[model samples]
Target: MKRKISTLLTFLILSLLIIPSSLAHDDQAKHDADLMCVFWGDDKVSLSSEEKIAFKIIANAAAITIDQYSLNPNGRIKEGTFNEIQEGLKYFGLPELSINFNDIDLNIKVSNDGKNISPNTHRLYTHLGWNYKKHPNNDFWKKRKHVLIDSVNRLLFNSKKIFSWFPWASDVVYPPSEQCDAFCAIIYYVHIIGDHIAGDTADKLKNIEPLIHYTSMDTPGIIVELKEQLQIVFQEQKNSYTFFELDQKLSDLTISIEKNCDILGFIDTAEKCKKNQEHAEQLLQILSKHLPTLLKNESFFKSRFK
Candidate 1:
């Protein structure tokens, strides 16, 4: 009887141990499956190390500018547009201008002048494009776009040129701009780029040659990753109700690029700065819509470090 009791006790203990171990193993397996499911559906595809880093930098700047624009709209100046020049200064941590143009003391003596308008003030007003009496011309808008594009293009190119000239000169300028009111324009560019380009064109912009390139060149590998991600996304939703919506977004970008570049006709209104910005934005939007698929690609996660 004692021997029988001993055998029964041992069997009960073993069964308890085995059951818990099996349950634990099953739980772990379920957890891993859940992780894989999310990984395949939520992440963007992998980017090359170089492209990843550059994209991060540009993306960070673009995000900040976009967020600020959404919140403040016409930041600083209440009229006209946001100044991109100022945004660049702020991005680089520069101090704000202490002297307001209205408050500045312009010591001018009027000597029998029929027009009492001082030359300095007149010039300042004209340059600021605040004169409502002047006929609205394309020159002012083009000039504003020109100044802003130069500032952004310089910021992007300056890093490469300086590094090429002197590898030791690696002080990357933050919020780089050439004008005091440049931030507004910078914000506008970021907004447009994010809206139109899908943010992937940043990859192509990096390969451009000297003096002609508008932004830094990123690795082509990154483009591959983006294209792969976009493909997966488009394929997954090719027949969905939202496919039409995504196609419309792509169409909008195409239209914007064509208009900015004057691809439809011989429009003399094509300015490189404006067109470049429009191009950048268009690329951003195109890439953005497919970001979910890229980020979630199973292969992307598996090969992220590789």
Candidate 2:
């Protein structure tokens, strides 16, 4: 009887020790999966070697644009910077974007003096970040999220479709207008290249749902708040914000969510909530750092191809 009781006690202790560790590992795996969904979406798109190089070049250009805007939000972009992007695209045989003067839907218009043209404020705001549109239904946020996923899908595959608007206008002048600033130029450049940089992977891409569906299955309100904040800041402020400002707003929202995670009682514990918050912040950091880092190491990226 004594031996049996001792063995039973040992078994109970071992179970207690092993079960938590196993749970922790499972939690970590879930966090990682959630982060992947936020960044890459549900479908996995693979890039070829040549396509990787093209993606890098375009990403670098975006990084350069972000860096410039962060430094001087109101300054004019350098002609050389624009030329470098154009040359990089040409080297990769990607389609160059020309202004579609016939497209009445384009947000560009003649200046007050009628001697110059430029993208309007609304265009600049929408291109640089998210924009809010009022809808009568509750699916507005979901639709907006779908738009983001679709843009990423186009970036990864079906890039040619992005440039199909003016496939034959190769010799057309870039900048479309001399009055283009950093905001106008970079937005135009990204819109053109984001579609085609993924090269021949077009057919393999798939549509994905919002990050909320994947990351915050238990508490989707948090993700909705995040999306709402992003749209409100850009839509209401016009063209008066910078990347750093936006980052702070997002960081604050994350922190608030972290604090309320336990009080909300949706997760198993405060520790799990904290871990999820950390993963979300990490995703934000990756986005904020990716472009600037690529631009800073532009030389290294270029040497890799050579």
> Where does model 1 exceed 4 Å of error?
1-229, 232-234, 241-244, 263-270, 293-306
Task: Name the top TM-score candidate.
Answer: 2
The weakest ten consecutive residues by lDDT in model 2 span 202-211
> How much RMSD separates candidate 1 from the native structure?
23.5
Give the Cα-based TM-score of candidate 1 against the true structure. Answer: 0.24
lDDT of 1 by residue, 1-306 (tens): 665455344433432331111111132222222222222322354556433332323323222222211112122211111222323323333322222222221122211232333322222222222112331233333333333333334334343443322312322433233321332232333233322222122322221211111122321222222233334434544555444554566556555545543432221233443455455444444444543343343232223223
Model 2 lDDT per residue over 99-139, tens place: 22121121122122322223222222222222223212223
